[model samples]
Target: MVRWVRALVVGAALAGMITLAGVVLGRIYADPLLVRLVAGAAIGSVGLSVGMRRLPNWTVAPLSATVLGAYTIVGLKLAAGQADVTGPLSQIARDSLVNGIPRLLTAMIPVQPAPDTVVVPVIAAWLAGLAAAEVAVRARRVLLGLLPVVALYAGALYVVGPNASAAGWTTPAFAGLAIVALATSARPAHAEVPEVSAKLRGRAMAGAAAGLVAVIALGAAVGPWVGGQVSASPVDPRRYVQPPQVDSLDESPLNRISGWALSPEQRLFEVSPTGAKSRTVRLRLAVLPDYDGITWRVGATYRNAGRVLPQLPRLPDATTADVRQEIVIDGLTGRLLPVVPTPTEITGARIAFDAATGTLIRPEQLSTGLRYSVVSEVQTPDVNLLPAADVPSGNAVARFLAVGPGVPERIQRLADQLADGNGAAFDRATAIEEFLAEHYRKVADAPSGHAYPNLDFFLFGPRAQGGQVGTSEQFAASFALLARLTGLPSRVVVGFDAPAGGGAVTAGNAIAWPEVLFNDLGWVAFDPMPKSKNPRPVEEDFTPKPTKPPTPPSEPPTSADTSSSSAPPAALAAATDGGPGAAVIAGGASGSVVLLLAGLALALVVMRRGLSRRRLTVGTPDERIGGAWAELRDALRLSGRPLPAHLAATEAAAYAKEPSAVRIRRAAPASEAAPLPPLDELVAGINTVGFAPGAADDAQADRAGSQAVAYATALRARRSWWRRVWWSLHPGPLRWRRPL
Candidate 1:
């Protein structure tokens, strides 16, 4: 009976190891690892139970376990509609095998597998378990039994390399545990049989264990470095990624933002703002008000900017210019055609407009060589003549003020701090604009992920701190987010920034800025990011107009500032001026790479911790106990000795066939963790919990859980500093798992 129990326990340990290894999918799947561990437990227990029964053929028990485990997983997913349960059995098999192939191929890892799609992995895992059980129990060979598990681990390693190290050693861990269980349980088929002495057997086990640990250590430490060396040099993936298709099947103007930011050589088009135009001109693509905390996108559909195209909103007493800008599209391809803000008329075939943004749209997919001319009525408002922002009666006002989800609380506070309480909206607007210009820096490159993930990282992520967020999009998005919190209507504008000589707009000139809406000035643009000086005028030509040679300054130019003979360098002076286009992008290319790498690392830590917590609280009574057990292993990995990959929990604890780190000192040298009676009790209580049919009870399960909590606290209290940092990334259960 004791031997059978030991075999079963080892089987369970193997299950755990494979499950942990399987968690590599967490990075790819949206669903958590808790869901997949179900299959791990089912496979392990079934194999062990059938084997312990002394079933007829060794293959019989393993094959039965494999079939049973596979069916159970498929049945569960089928019930969930992950796979089609309505289809004939053969058809379901065909779909799971055939249709699932491509999905598994292109599918990213650690991903949440689909109902039907996950079937393949589940079956693959079953086969692995079957092979493992046959070797370990029937053939009774440790290395061969571990082969299938090793294959799974190696495959996971090849797929993600070091990135999957968070759960890297599960296979060896369980296999060692299984070997110990079998060794301890062995009493020979015949009592008279003599075999290798106990010491030699022990030495063999030790050598095998040492080899496994060495293999894992090398792979974990050296694999990524090797992979990096062999692979192409690291480049920011976002640099190559096309613009985001903002919430539509068809591309929106915003979709091309990243491409524009990354490309400086390619020209999107040339804007001739031909006649009767202000010195400064900004082409409008989209005016977005709907911010779902991640992206800014237009919620409303297209309407005519005017009966014809490019019509500006009529403002009372506002000086309007009847201007014409001829735009010649280049390499850019999109359904949305770029236009200057407030065009009075646009001449083109198949052009539409969204008055919401004063943008022109081409319904068809864009092709090169597209041309359009716009006749616009632009409102040129000077600060002195413009009215102070006052209350406006417009539907647009409310939409602009609506704040999205992830606007950090600190940003809102900063906005309030900078804005004057008694001043009009314009005063607040100026203050905010100036605040961004002075406080926020601009970089030429765009950062990936949502603009602001961890505010601390964005605000103080780099060693440079204040200067890290230096990009037009960052400047514009941050300003818009803050302005909305300040009770002003704000949105981000993305469009081509025509060079000063208004001849052509290159991809480099694709810039973004904030536009705040006021009752007095409709969507007024604010340039918070610095850019190069535009020529005095973006006109047809700057050829020196025939000038009377040398009229010279009226008098020898007297020193403008007599007190200051030494002026600041051009770059330093420009940076200190605190205006849009004042500061050059700081290591814009490298900054993006740093941000991407940092974000990826942070995300991995967060997901690992969250999964650890979720695994503890979620599952059936047996499953919950299993979760707590897994959490204990995670905790031990930090505070206790670094678990050797080949050592099962008991072996690592320096014991045989005993689960849990019953004696912490064995795994942790000089360990001061107090004896946890509850831990021992919990381990003993769960001896039957879900290991076999009808082996669990409410009382046993509850006691085991309380003991787990007690043990966890005691174990974690004694961790070293480095371990404590690791522990932070493995958060505890703060909330009870909702019943699944």
Candidate 2:
């Protein structure tokens, strides 16, 4: 009973380690909490339970691991809406199982829960948990349990690489080590312990205290160096590049409101419009026109010469207000430089501009404390005089109005549901914008478990879907996607914002909104995220309504020409863009984790096999009797008697008086009842061979060894599942390694 409790306590500790690792790794990849917790708990409980056992250790470990791998693969496929059982699961096995251990060790930490992401963590956590249980419960080596827990953290660090905070995850692992110590200190026997005499045990307590401190100090000193040397990012970028990195941005649609609520009170950057602006102004970073059903991004990118931007593609009849804005970047993050819409010129030496997308970029990554000025003609169209595209035409129309597959028909139906089938572009856009304001609720962080592409969830999901609630990105993505379905050339724009009343901007100032293109008006912006009360009208910077606007800059590019110009780079024109661009590095000490587990598994097999063969197969005649006797005790355990501490082996023996008795039994299935052999005969032989060596009968000793092995094998075959579990936790050999 005490031993069983100790085993359970150790199992609990291992489960905690797995849970902690799962949560941390999941967060880095933006996996939903529910998903991580459920998966972690289910896998950890089973894995750790099996690990703490001593019976069937060889086959059990391998069998459990295979099941874990299969479960993860199948479950993920089901959740992803792929085929139920065979096709998708088989493909996953084919892709990942060939190099099973290798691929698992090499898998990347994807933000979304992809197949590799799900399988690798479950398999790794189970393996680690099993080791922790075995070390703590079976070996009764408390300190050794830390090995597997540490290895677990190390594997996570390698996979997560530099994506999240490393220091934050180590605290729980250290706690698990403490639990290991407590579990290991408990004796496995059921009997009560003799009271300790204080005087005699005085130095024992002190010595243990000192030893613990010394071990902790040693771990702390070594941990940093070892941890720093490991990495999980994919080493082969050319072969398997992570998507392009999105710095400090969680681009999920549900993040909309939190971004708005971003340290609004804390100024991240300062902006001063050269000319007093009419209202709050937004500093455009990049105009993303391509929607891959999930997110929006710039389709085409180009590097402009430092500071100088090419003239805005000549709009025919639109009024432009040149506003010079000086910006002092404080604490904000992103690679693209910020400028007000319609930038005519930028004053900086090391900046590059993408003329087609109107994006100002630094050759490398963005930095803090950046100060720059921009010359921009912020455009606002005359509502009455705005270009009328009853039937819009231009080369860029198809590209601007493009819709990716999987867009639900409900989105298109919503447009028709709200307005007449046809209306002027401006009127239709305004109606869509108003409809969004009226129906959707603006939520900063949506609950976990929202489906992927999340479009369906945003539009029609439950309450949390009592109303559509999401961040600006979702609103913009949905509105733009929906707007495009209605024949309005629409796209989503993401950038830094400078409101009229505020002098400084913060993370909350990072914003996204929808934009529509008119042949004569170029691209126009609008707001779709719902407001708390009376929603503010979308801002448009216009020189007071003008008559007969300036005309004839040039005819808008044709659809064919626009597609040719604004298309994404040929090298990266996939359905999904901006993933870690070769960022997951899978080499180094981190990459060697799989090799470690593999080596450990192999070494265990060889050790167990060699030990068994020596004890049961071959040895000197007398040695065989000792070996045979040892085998009989374990055989009883496998037979399910297990000889609980209160039961005496001598009293329980069916025959303790005879040395020449033969007690071999044939092999049978594990579920049936198998009789225990004549242990008295085996013990008598052991006494003769071990104490009165010269008097030993060689034939009797060999026969006992052979019969002992055969009976143990039969007992093993007839062992029940629970019996196997019981001995697996406290197998006799586990205690053979006396304390150093």
Candidate 3:
């Protein structure tokens, strides 16, 4: 019992020592600190179990557990920086009073994100220690010898700095406790025969010590290797805004202004009329009241510009058609633009632009381009109505209607000359539209600057200038303003005029027309342009030109086969016939199948060979028992006494009446014994040949060979019923089979 206890202690101590070595080596390799610590604890526990025979059982368990726990704490500290902040612990403590507590808790949870580096090693050490303690207690040992030394080491650590050296002290303290318990409970020697030989005891102790050292070395080596392969690299650190510049122009006030420049390339307006050819439309143009510098500033107004008078009865309803048109502009850089309808009160207006352009178009300077759309009602006017007794005041359009420039004066003068009396609003409006159409000529260019002040430049300027026409937008504005001045309610309508091509016309092809409002009818559109020889309709569709397809190149012809005939006939034939393109494919497939089959056959052969070798190498007590058993089995089979199935060599020997069996059992160093006939002599001879620091001579080798052969021959001789039975039971011939 004492010997067994010693053996167990030695094993446990050896396991612990090995673990410590591994941890130290691992640290040197820059392994994760946690990994190193855990590995160290585990190796220590293993070494203690397998190597340290003198270590007490009670000491092993607590010591191993404490070492492992310390390792775990160290590993955690090393890997703490890499833990995820949003993990379980973090989530739980997200709203907690103490920050990071939840994160710490989550990291401690096992197998969530991934296992900790120290987990395996720590667990291993703890388990090993536990097992060692249980084994020692079961063996009923007392008084562990190493307890005092461990306690001293732990006390020294505590004296240095209790809190700071907690990890260093914990392992030694546990080891001390384990050793004390084991030593106090250690069993006394028996009064009868000695349970263990001094030589055997010494060897066991030495092996345990060696194993402990091995474990410690292994732990040190493994720890650093694991750490380096696992951990993430470290973040870079930016300014927010730039400094402002001086003397920048003030653009805030521009937001309220409606006026915007239409570069030469910009489409000012678009016009599309139902069932009307897209011919050039002559119209009037005008600007609202505003101050002018290099450009006009038309302010946006919250006031309703075209509200109907309350005093006047509503005019009779007229069937009016609503025309839809798209207006596109060019050379516009910024996003937002102002859109206003002429003769106002017109709704159903919507504008769209690229999604990238948000609601606001900033830096309202000349560089910020603008575009919008307008919808207006147009219809023919009724030719009868009485003039109002008094026009409303504070109405800009009403005032303009009473005595505006251009067509108003001409209409009044013509009415006085023709009727010899004042004309009503309906009659005046009709006469003005006809007179203007007859008088004005549509041209591409009109007067600019002060030359076109009011409507005089467009209506009564020089004949050469009169024939010149500006954009449809200019024409429509001029006409609408003139009509309003002449007591005719009118407004300009801007929309797209489809071209003759068969495709959709965009805002890029915009045109404008005037709509005159007469009492009892509605607004009516009129074109004042002169007829041209090659006029194109505005509403015709335009189709895009078709694209051409690319052509393919012709393939070059293949050259005739050519080859020398000196090669093998089959090779020569293959070369002349485009090589082995098809045959090679077939051969490759066949070869692959053959290789696969051959590999499987080889594996089976190797497995069979291994099994046979294993069977042959049984029933031997020495370290190389496999080889001895093979020779013994062959020798027994030839003796004719069949060996019983599943019987141990000891039982078989007892039945054989061999005196050598007793000596075999008594051999102290079993590794030096040879299992064959004349077992006593063989065992003694082999013991003499035990491992030592010396070279072998030729005479020694011959003598050893001769002895081995003689023993084999004696085992083969059938002398008794037991021997004959063993021989008969065992197979005779030794067959050598080659590996597949």
- Of the candidates shown, which would achieve the greatest lDDT relative to the real structure? 2
lDDT of 3 by residue, 380-479 (tens): 2343333331122234334233323233343223322222111334344445445444445554344332112534444444544453234454455555
The alpha-carbon lDDT assigned to residue 59 of candidate 3 equals 67
**lDDT tens per residue, model 2, 33-98:** 325633564455445454537675576666666666656565556433321112455675555445
> Per-prediction RMSD in angstroms?
30.7, 38.5, 47.9
lDDT of 2 at 192: 35
Q: Between candidates 1 and 3, which one is better according to TM-score? A: 1
**Over 4 Å off, model 3:** 1-422, 449-458, 461-485, 489-515, 519-526, 531-740
Cα TM-score per model: 0.37, 0.37, 0.24
- As for lDDT, the candidate ahead, 1 or 3, is 1
Candidate 1 TM-score, C-alpha based: 0.37
* lDDT by residue (tens digit), candidate 1, 1-740: 87566556656655654565466544434455323643554365446544654766644755566656566555545533531234466565566567554444333233334434355556556666666766665565645666776686555444444333344355457557656755754665533324756667688899999999999999999999898875544332223323223336233345455556676788677777454334556677666677767766766445322124424457655677666777777777656677766765655434445555666666356676767677767785655643444634244366776655555544544554554232355666676666556544455564533345633244434424433454566667777876665556788777766643468777887777788765545667887664333212211121224435666666543456423546556644564666544234656766899999778668767786566555545556677666656555444433422222223333333421123332232246554544544455455544565346346565665666666555556665555444445555543233312121
Better of 1 and 2 by lDDT: 2
Q: Model 2: residues >4 Å from true position, as ranges?
A: 1-263, 447-453, 464-467, 531-740
